[model samples]
Each structure stands twice: as structure tokens, then as C-alpha cells.
Target: MAVGELSEKRPTRYEIEDVEAADRRSRWRFRILFAVVWLGLIIGLAVGLALTGRIDPAFILEVGPFILDGTPTTLLICFSSILLACVLATLGALGRLSGNPVLNAIASFYVSLLRGTPLVVQILFWYLALPQFGVVLDALPAGIGALAFNYGAYMTEIFRAGVEAVPRGQQEAARALGMRESEVMRRIVFPQALRIVTPAIGNEFIAMIKDSALVYLLGVREVLWRADVMGTRFFRSTETLLIAAVVYWILTIVLSFFQERLERRMARGDR
Candidate 1:
């Protein structure tokens, strides 16, 4: 073939660019299509339930306020429990990583037992069983203590992983500067670990919010408990429960949005 003919047959630079851009657009379209399908499915399910008479519009209207009224109590328990969990998690993480065998054993035992048992059992133990031992607790305190203990066990691993993820050299450098082990951890290690684990911690917090629903078993008037009360009162248990579900979903979505933003900000700071 002649050189001129060969050159003419080759794809132009603009043609190649156009093909690449088309590929990128197609990929975006595929992603958008997937999202649309999920959104459509969710909408369809809601419409189906409404049409099938499984969900009561009238009851929803009547009970919505009652359910919402309990959101503050739910939030209070969630935040308070997570606060206590954070403290326990910090102590547990430190103990787990410590050289002291006694601390290590104690931390390990706590984590093992808490993680092994069902959360409901722990809640009952705190509220019901503990009273036999002269450790009677009011409903709120019992619920909060159970939540904190359960989540602390789980979060201990997250904290430990975050702390361990820090490079050994950082600790070594701090120690070389005449810092004691405690100072090195406090001044250098824990802060960085916190950044590493903040997203995971946020996720745990969100999960805890939902798990807090179980506090209803203790007769705490959180969202689910209030929903049950309204449901029983009006004989519209299904509708009330659905409303509570929606409220919890909304809360989680809002929290997740902030969690993502915080994660991105932390990532940027790392860079």
C-alpha cells in the first residue's frame, strides 16, 4: 500500500478521542441505570404495599406525630451509649495492646464474652438478672450500659486495628525524642489512630442507632417502643411499625451523608 493510502486508513486522533469519550459516557450511563433500577424497585415496593392495603394511610397520619415524638429519646440513648462505648473501647484497645498480661487477659475476656452473647441477652441481664445481685438499674441506665458494653467489645477491634496500622517508626521516633511510652501513645499514636478509625466509628454509631431499637424490651420509650405503644393503642401495629422504620431509615441516611463527608475531609487531610 502507498504511504498516503496507509495514513488515510489510520484512525485520526480526534476519532480515537471520540471513542474514548464514548466509552466513558457509556460507563456513566451503566452506573446511572443501575441506580435507577434500585430506585424504581424501592418505589414499586412502596406503591405495591399501599395498593395492597398492607399499609394504612389513615393510621400513618394519626401515628406519625407520636412516633416522631420519640426520636429525641432515641437520639439521646444512641449518643449517650456511643459516648460510653468510646471510652470503654479506648481502654479496651489500650489493654489489648499492652504488655501487661493481666490487662490483656481482662480485655480479651471482656471482648470475647460480649461479642459471643446476643445483645438482647445482655440487655436482659443488665435489667433483669442484675437486680438479683443487688445491681438494680433503672430502664435508661440499664439500656445505656448494655449498649455501651456490647458496642465497646466490637469497637475494641476497630480501635486496635487503627492503632496498630500506625507505623512502628512513629512510635520509635517519639521514644527516641525522650518521650515515655504513655506520652508517645497520647501525643503521637492515638490521634492518628483516631483519624484512621473515625469512619469505622461513625459506621458503628449508625448501627448502634438501629440496635438501640432493642431498648424497647427494657420499656424505654424510644422510637420503636413508642411506635409499639401507638400501634397497640390504635390497633394499627403494621402502619406504626412502618412509620418507625421510615424514620429510622431517614436518620441513618442523614448520618451516613455526614459520615461520608467527614471521611473525605479526613482523607484530604491525610494527603
Candidate 2:
């Protein structure tokens, strides 16, 4: 009698494994789809530029001088203005935190006024109004002052947040050690606050760099304006603008690398 032998098979892990693998493949496909879409868009834009006669060599060369020089000029304006803004912001934050009501009110009002006004208006105001007081500043200085004023108001919140981030017990600990409020703040609070606020400050730096472009509207000849001038004069507007965009992208990337490193370093200290 040929009895039917029981066919023994191990239970398959195939279904579960297949589902997981399929999910991974689907995720990869989604990512690839997104990347391809963006890539196509960028290529389309580049092609459009070429078709529009924007990539012409004569156009690129026409404003090369302005394009090159405008980079360093923009950097100078941004760096100097940001430095000044940080200084003023620190002081304003201190004033706001101070016990004196008058100082607090003045600091608050300064922040309110600057934050309330449009940055372009501030730039124009500094450029146009200051001359009425017989204190005409060069384009560079006027531009810096306008940027600093606008950013300083914004930075007050950053500084204040930093100061407030320090544990209250830190101040009390300093006081327990017989230190005065000023000394405690200088020695303990500000240092901690700086570290805490460094990332926020880096963000402000990026914003300031972009905002520096507005200085060109005041005829300071920064990168964007230089590109505009070159493009208009030679009708190679696309090439010049592309070059400017590349320059700004490079700068932003470089700065971002440092920011990331600093953040990692700060986080390490936290651990």
C-alpha cells in the first residue's frame, strides 16, 4: 500500500520578509521620485536660460569685474554689520534685563521701533535722512548702520532667550559664592548664554548675509546688484545672475559647515 507520505515543509518566512523588503523598495522609489522631480525642474530652468540667450559669454564677461568685486564687498558689509549688531544686541538685552525701569523701557522701545519698520525703509532712511543732520555717511557705512539697526532689534530676542536659558540656580549659585549680580552675569551667565545662543546667532548671520543684498538697492554695488547691472548692460542677465547665485550658494554652504561643526561641539559639551 503506497501510503501518502506526509510532505513536511518548514513554515515560510517569505511573506513577512517580502513585505519588509517591498516596503523598503517603495521608500527608495519615493525618494528617487522626489529627487528626479527636483532634478528635472532644475534642468528645465537651466535649459530655459540657455534658450533665452542668457548663457552668452559676452554677457558673462560684461559684468565680471562687478561680479567678482561685489562678493568681497558684500562679505565685508555683512560681517561688519553683524558684528555691530551683536554688540548692540548684547547691550540692549542687558538693558532689558536690568532692574531700572527707564532702561528697560528704552530697550523695549528700540526693539519695537526697529522690528515695526520695514528693513528697506530703514536702509533708505539711513541713506537719505542722515544727510539732513550734516552727518552724511558713505554708502558702506550707511548700509552697515541700517543692517545693524534692523538686525539688532531681532537679535535682542535671541540674546534675551540665551540669557534666560541659563538655569536660575546658576545665578543663585554665583550669589551664594558672594558674587555680585554684575559679576555673576559677566562670569557665568554670559558665557553660558553665548554657547546656547551660538546656533541662533548663526541663523541671524545667514539672514544678515541675504539681507546684505538690500544694500545694493542703496547703490552699494553688492553681488546681486552687480549681476543686475551686468545683465542689463549686456543682455546676458541669466549668466550673470547664475554666477551670483552660485557665489551666494557657495558662501551659504561654507558658513553652514562651520555652523554644523559648532553645533556638534556645543552638543558634545552638553553630553
Candidate 3:
């Protein structure tokens, strides 16, 4: 192109630049507006609190423990229970896939029993009814066991899906290479299946964490129970609940972040 033609093209560059600038401005405008509205509301509240001499940002610190107790207890129960549940789920999946009718029936019944009853009922049954039969567990153990059994039933399906997703050709290839069926599964299929369902299984883990709070009904001293006790005793229902809400939000967010990273690593193995 001649110099004169190039000069004309430089003006088109400004047109493209203007479009890009406008796009960025549009994107940030609403974001800034959202921040402004929220900021104004918070500032207004703080000002009102100062005028009334009721402002104490540090006040929440005292109430935070009542909320954090349930979170830690909930986390511990969920982690332990979900760990056992995963193991049970793996066995159940294998049993369901087995050729033996006895094994299959046992696995099927386990799933049915857990799923058929309400989780709350099962918790009560384990905590209360078991005592009548001389099989009583402390509140924590009973709650954990109930959580595991219930989650195991759901995870059975996840594990089974993972197992079944393994391509038939991969199995045949393993067999043709003189690998035993069990070896083939252990070395090949299980790993892939695990990767395939990692995301779903992580979800189950987080769900287990939340459900652990239901154990409060059993009078366990977890976070929510602590929140209730503190709220009642201190007459700070709103503050106590806000603390618990923050705990749950933080826990879920931290867990989900790692789960996402784990999924990404698993996906990388595909390449």
C-alpha cells in the first residue's frame, strides 16, 4: 500500500481502539456501580452506629466461637464419615459389578437400607433406639455413622458410574496382555474411573460436611449446636447466626477451590 493509503488505515486503528475502550468502560461501569451502592449502604450503617454509640466491630469476635465450634465438629465428622463412606462405596461398587449373587444382594441391601429411611430418623435410631438394644453410641459416633451410611448409598452410584465408564476395549487390551482381571482393574480401570468422578465425589464430600450439622439434633457439640446455645444464652441471635454463616461459607469455598485444582490435575493426565 502507498504511504497515503497507510495514513488512511491509521484512522481505522483509532476506530478499533475506540470500540475496545468502550467495551472496557461498559464492563467496569456496572461493576463500579455495584461497589458504590454497597459501599454507601455500609458507610451509612456505620455512621448510624457511631451516632448511637453502638458500633463495635470487635463485638463479633466474642460471638464467633459459638459459631466456629460447630464448624470444626461438623468438618471432623464429615471428613471421617465421608472417608469411610468412600471405602464402603468402592466395595459396594465392586460387589454390584461382581458375578456372585450373594455379594450383589449384600451390596444392594446396604444401599436400600440407607436410602429407604430418612437420614434424620436414622440418626435418631442410631442415637436413641440403639441404646434400647444395648448398642448405644455416643452422640458423635452415632452421628458420624449415620452420615457415613447415608452418604455411602449415594456414593455407590457414583462409584458404579466411574467403574462402568471404563471402555470395554481397555479391559480387553489388559486381558490380552496376560493381566489378571483384578490386576487390570487396579492398574487401569480404577484410576481412570477415579479421575472421571473426582468432581462428583468432591461434591459428595462437601455435601457430607453440610449434612453433618444435622447431627445437632442428636445433641452433639458441633458448630450449629454451639451457635444455638450461644444465641440463646447471650441473646444475640443475629450475631451468632452470622458467625455460623461465615464459617460454612469459608469452609465450602476453601474445599471447592482445592477440588477444582484437583480436577484440573486429573484432567491434565489425559494429555
Candidate 4:
């Protein structure tokens, strides 16, 4: 190749630097635009509420503390439900992947039924229908049970996907080392699967925290229930509901931050 042609073909250092700088500026512009869009939406919501005369500053001031006090109860139910869900998801995932036909069928049916039905209906059934079958449960327990079963069914797929993502060669190598199937799963497969699934589980946990408000249908006295009571008492349903929505949004953002950190830590571990 001619010397002049070779120089033309390879970009000069200044050209490469200019291209990289332009790319960085474009990315930063997109980031700023994204942030502004979200901020605008939030401000628009507030303006709409005010223009509609649906919110009262005095009511917010008076009732906000009372409603905020229910955060602990909401968190309690969310964490409790997630704990149960994790256990159920693990077992359901194992059953679905098991060699035994009955186990597989049971797991399949459980996931289908729970995932197919509305979570609200499930909550009502646990709260009301079970008594006829002599499995009466208190409101909190029934709500937690409904949440656990519903989330467990959904998360079962996450667990299964995580487990399946683990390399088959690793399992075969474990077997070659004389480890039984169960032992291999316990010591090798599950730990790795856990790392893969943890971020997904965190996302589900955040979703469940929002869904936990549905437990209000069971009179579980969580944040939504408190908001309802405050709205009804003060005749400011819109305000209270909006406040509840804001609280939930804030909580979800905070949880998401922690989830991101958890994901980063797990990624570091993988490295």
C-alpha cells in the first residue's frame, strides 16, 4: 500500500480523540435528557393534582405522619412474605426440575394456578374460603400466605432459569468426582444459581413491597389500609391515595438503590 493511502486508512490520534469526545458528550446529553423527563413527569403530576383541587395541603400535613407510621407494618409484611417466597421458590424450582413425575406435576400445577389467578382473589380466598375447609388463618398470616404463594410461583421461573444457566459441564465434573446429584446441587449448583438469581429476587422483593398494599383487602393494617382509613375519616381520599402512592414510590426507589448495590457486589464476586 502507498504510504499516503496507509496514513489515510488509519485515523490520526487527534481524529480518534475527537470521536471519543463527541461520543462522551452525546451520552451525557442523553443522561441529562432522561433525568429531566422523569423530573418533568413528577412535577406534572403534582401540578395536575393541585389544578384538580384533589389535594389539600392542610390534610397532607395533618395526616401524613399517621400514614407514614404504617411504613414499618408495610415493610414487615413485605419482608415476611419475601422470606416465605424464597423458601417456596427454592422448593418449587427443585420440584419442577426433579426426575419424579409427581413432583414435577405438583410444582407445575402450583405455579400455573397461582400465576393464573389474580393475587387479590387469592388473598380473599385465604382470608375467607379456607375457614370452610378448617384452615382458618388470621388476617396477617393469611395475607402473608397469599403474598408468599403468589410471589413464589412467579419467582420459581427465575430460580429455574438461574439453575439452568449454570454450565452443564460443571455438573458433569461434580458427578465425575463421585458427588451424588443431591450433593452436587447442594454444594455446587445452588450457590452459583443463587448469585445469578439474587438480583432478580431483589427486583421481585421491590415489586412485592408494592403488591403488599393488596393485603389491605384482608384488613392487615399496612400502609394502604392506614391511608384508606385516613382518607375515609377526613374525606380526602384523593390526597391520601396520592400520598400513599408517593410513599410507595419513594420506598421502591430506595430499595432499588440497595438492589443495584447488591447486584454490583455479586458481579464483583463473579469476577
Give one digit per residue, the lDDT tens place, for model 3 in 210-250. Answer: 78878988889887788777778977666666667667767
User: How do the residues 5-82 of candidate 4 rate in per-residue lDDT, one tens digit apiece?
Assistant: 755798576655577799999999999999999999989988987898767898899999988988999999999999
Candidate 2 per-residue C-alpha lDDT over 78-123 given as tens digits, one digit per residue, 9 for 90 to 100? 8999999999999899888988999999999999999999999999
TM-score of each: 0.89, 0.82, 0.79, 0.88
Which residue pairs does candidate 4 place in steric collision? none
For candidate 2, what is the lDDT?
A: 0.88
Residue 208 miss distance in model 3 (angstroms): 1.3
Candidate lDDT scores, in order, read: 0.93, 0.88, 0.84, 0.92
The alpha-carbon deviation from the true structure for residue 243 of candidate 3, after best TM-score superposition, in angstroms, is 1.9
Clashes of each: 0, 0, 4, 0
